[model samples]
Structures are given as structure tokens and as C-alpha cells.
Target: MKHVTKADGGRQPFDPEKVQRTLRKMGVGAEDAERIAGEIAESVPDGVRTAAVLRMIRARAKAVHPAVSHRTNLRRALGLLRSKPDFEEFVRVLLREHGYQVETGCVLAGRCGEHEVDAVAEKDGTTVFVEVKHHVSHHRVTGLDEGRIARAIIEDLQEGFRSGRCVVAIDGALIVCNTKLSEHAKRYATCRGIGHIGWDYPEERNLRTMIEETQSYPITIVAGVSRSVSTRLAAAGVVTAKQIAYGDATTIAHDADIPLKEVLLIAGRARAILEA
Candidate 1:
């Protein structure tokens, strides 16, 4: 009916079509999404916060099935991860889903310095040195300064390869981040020939779109997936819900060294999230 307050305290005119699009992205049928968006637009007050609208939408999603809410609960789940180590692992798994062979925690010597890479990803014989920037806050943005740093890193890595200081052959550099990118960041990355993936940048190929399309949600998306459980699973290279949903339960259970029953419960929850 009026402007909706964003999480960052900015306001935007309430549009039911936008809500419907979000619902459809979350896998609500087109007819249902339209109906639900219409209902919210009519019922909500002028000053309602966007968070409140999402809560109302989530309630409706859960009415269809408890797991339906998980489809769009990615924001909260990703924010819960311990940013550095956990986020790096999550991105590694996401890259794997997109057909990249990823190696994490790689250290390479540059012409002037040594840089620690979040991942070295290869696909179709092309390799990239990936730098992962993770933000716990929903409102934080990946800015141009981050791009500047990444560009320098890429330049150094290129020099290292040319001079035979770095053993691995790298074709380019990429920045993988959990939040949206600033306009300057996008421009800089493009001008410098650096590949970038942000939450909603690059439109069709952004991180959020890729996650939904590949169904490569982090293991933490499951309810009650404690730090201990995730740590154990990560030790066995199980970082995504898709891995749990499709992997052999017995093997995963043994490899993670957690009980079979617990693994089944986790797998069951992962399956529910995917199939919701």
C-alpha cells in the first residue's frame, strides 16, 4: 500500500509483483505466488517493515509444508556460518556444483609476496585463483576497495606464474562473496578483467541464483545442525545439503564418525529442504 522499510532502513514502494517474483523463486507455484502476494499487499499496513512481510510469507510457505520455508531461509542460514573457514568451504562446494574442481587453503608465492587463496578452482582446463569475501551482516556490501585488493592479487599471481615462482598455472582471478556488490566494485572488477560473483550481481549467474538453481545449500540449512555436527561433516567433505541428500547414508555416517541415526536425521532434513 505504501513504502516498505528495507533492512538497511531505506524505503521502497511496496509492489506486489516483486513479492510474487520472490515467491516464485522460492518455488511457489505461479498461481499461488500471485494469490499470496495479492493477499499481503491488501492486508499489510503502510509502514510495515520488509522483515515483517517476509515473516508473513514464510508462515504461508510453512502451511504448505514445514520445509517450504527453508527454500528461502538462505539468508539466515548463511549468516550463521563462521565466516572465514566455513564460508570458504561453502563456496568450494558451490563451485563443485557448477562443475569446478576446487582446492581450498592454497598458498601461492607471488612475485613480491605470498597470498593465501580461499580456493583454486578449475573447469574445462581453465583455472582461477578465488578470493572469498563473506559478510555476516545482511546490509553490508562488497565495495570497490575489495576489488582493488583482488586486482592487485591477480596481478601478482600473474607475475608469479610468468616468472615461474608459482607452480600452478592460473588463467585469471575471481571474487566470490556472500553479499551484494557496490556499483563501483562491479565496474572495477569488469574493467580489470577479474571475474566476480556476489549475492545478486551478474543477474542470472549471481551467487543467489546459482545456489537456488543448483540446490547447493550449505549443510547448516538443516535445523539443529550444530557447530559440532557441521564440523564433523565438513571433516568428511560434506559441506552442502545436496551432498547429504544424495550420498550414501552409511558411508557418510561412518566417515563423519557420527552415529548412523543422527546422519539419517540430518539427511532426512536435507532431503525435506530440497524436496520442499
Candidate 2:
């Protein structure tokens, strides 16, 4: 196999088995996975991009199973959550779907001091205070600063727990980020019983799995759409692709001042993607 360049500019030998394995992980049957791998191997030339290969596999998988495409490409969709405020809103939606009532950017007084909580969540008699650490890109990894963040959060939780902010008592202090956590931080959180929800934490209930479960795909998932346009759409309060799909394109165009033709196309693509 020839070497292929990755999106991060690293080079590695192309492996069709990797494609098949990913497909299988997405619930594709063995025969179909092998067939898809064969097609990708034949289609991709030497020196092709790994990202391009992924896009090809996603496209082909979408033809067979829609969830496969959405699940596989979710990290890219989530990377579109460029701003801290937007990431918070995305978390709100996610929590809401998970049956948690959420409040964002609230200040709670602890026994030691006042702490600004990123989000406060309540579900089934449990109250959770969340501190969101959002990154603009996947290149950033949280919890890499020698457990400084984890230690600080644990300390905050201690004060909050002592203060008795919740009538039923505080359940846990959760740190949710749009990227991964460092091993040290993970260990720290685990030891302290702090909940860490990263892009791929909690195994089954990661951000990608949650998004797929709720079908709340973000606007960034639509291919061929520029980040500028998606950012503008998010600014206009259209954060999810499902919103664009179910909404009126004309109204969106008039409000956002985007051309009606382009708005329609974006909505069409979103509808097709979610429907497939």
C-alpha cells in the first residue's frame, strides 16, 4: 500500500482493512464491509488524503446506512462548534434529550467561595454542576496541564458539596469538553469521582453517540458548506441540521440575508442526510 497524507499532515501507509474495521464497528455486515473496502482501495490513488478516503467511505456507507455516516463523521460535525457559547448550547440540547433540565452560566455560592458554573443540571432527584471546557478545534486536548484543571475542579466540588447548594445534595461535578482528556486528568477525575465527559468519554454515551441517538446533528455536518456559512447560521440561532431541515428556507434566507437558492440547497442537503 502507498503512503497517504492525513488531515494533520502526517503520512501513513494506506490500509483497506482499517476502512473495513471502521465499517464493521458502525454495524456494517462483514461482506458489505469488505466490498466497501475493496471499492475504496480501487478508487483511491497513491498519495491520496486520508480525510478524502474517510469522506469516500462515509458517502458509500451513507448509501447503505444513514447512521453509519452520521456516527462516523460526528467529530467533524462537532468541530463546527467553534465558540464556547455555542458548545454550551449544544451541551444544553444534549442534556435535555438525556432527560436532564439544564441551566447555563449560573453562579453558585460555595462554603469557601462563589463559583461560576458553566451548567447546572437536574434529573431524577440528582443535581449535577457542569464546567464546560470547550476548544475551537480538535487539536486542543484538555487535562494535559498536569491535572491542574482536575484538581481545581475537585477542590471546587468540595466547597460546593459543603455549602449544600442543592436540597437533595450535589450529585457530582462534571467537566465536559469538545475534545479528549489527558491520561493524568482522566486518572485524577476517576480517583476523585468527578465526571469527565469528553468527545469520547463514558464509552457508550460519548458526544458522538449521544448526537446520533437523538438525531440532533449539528449544522456543520452538511458537506460542501463553508464554515463561514455554518458559523453565520449558528449565529442566527440555527445550530442543528435538523433545524435547517425542518425550518422554512425562505424565512431563514430573509433573516440571515443568505440567498434563497443557497438556503434551499442547504436545507435540502440536511433533509436528505437525516432522512437517509
- Number of the top-ranking candidate, with lDDT as the measure: 1
Identify the runs in model 1 with alpha carbons over 4 angstroms from their true place.
69-72
lDDT, model 2, position 228: 74
Clashes of each: 0, 0
How well is each residue in 1-276 modelled by candidate 1, as lDDT tens digits?
388998878889999998888776666788888889989999999878999999888787566547774444686677767776777888988888899999877998889999998889999999998988888885788898877887788788889989999888888888988888999899888998889999888998998888888988988888788888888888888888989888999999999999999999888888988887
Question: What is the total number of backbone clashes in candidate 2?
Answer: 0
Candidate 2: tens digits of C-alpha lDDT, residues 194-247:
777888877888776787788787787777667778767766777788878899
Worst 10 residues of 1 by lDDT: 64-73
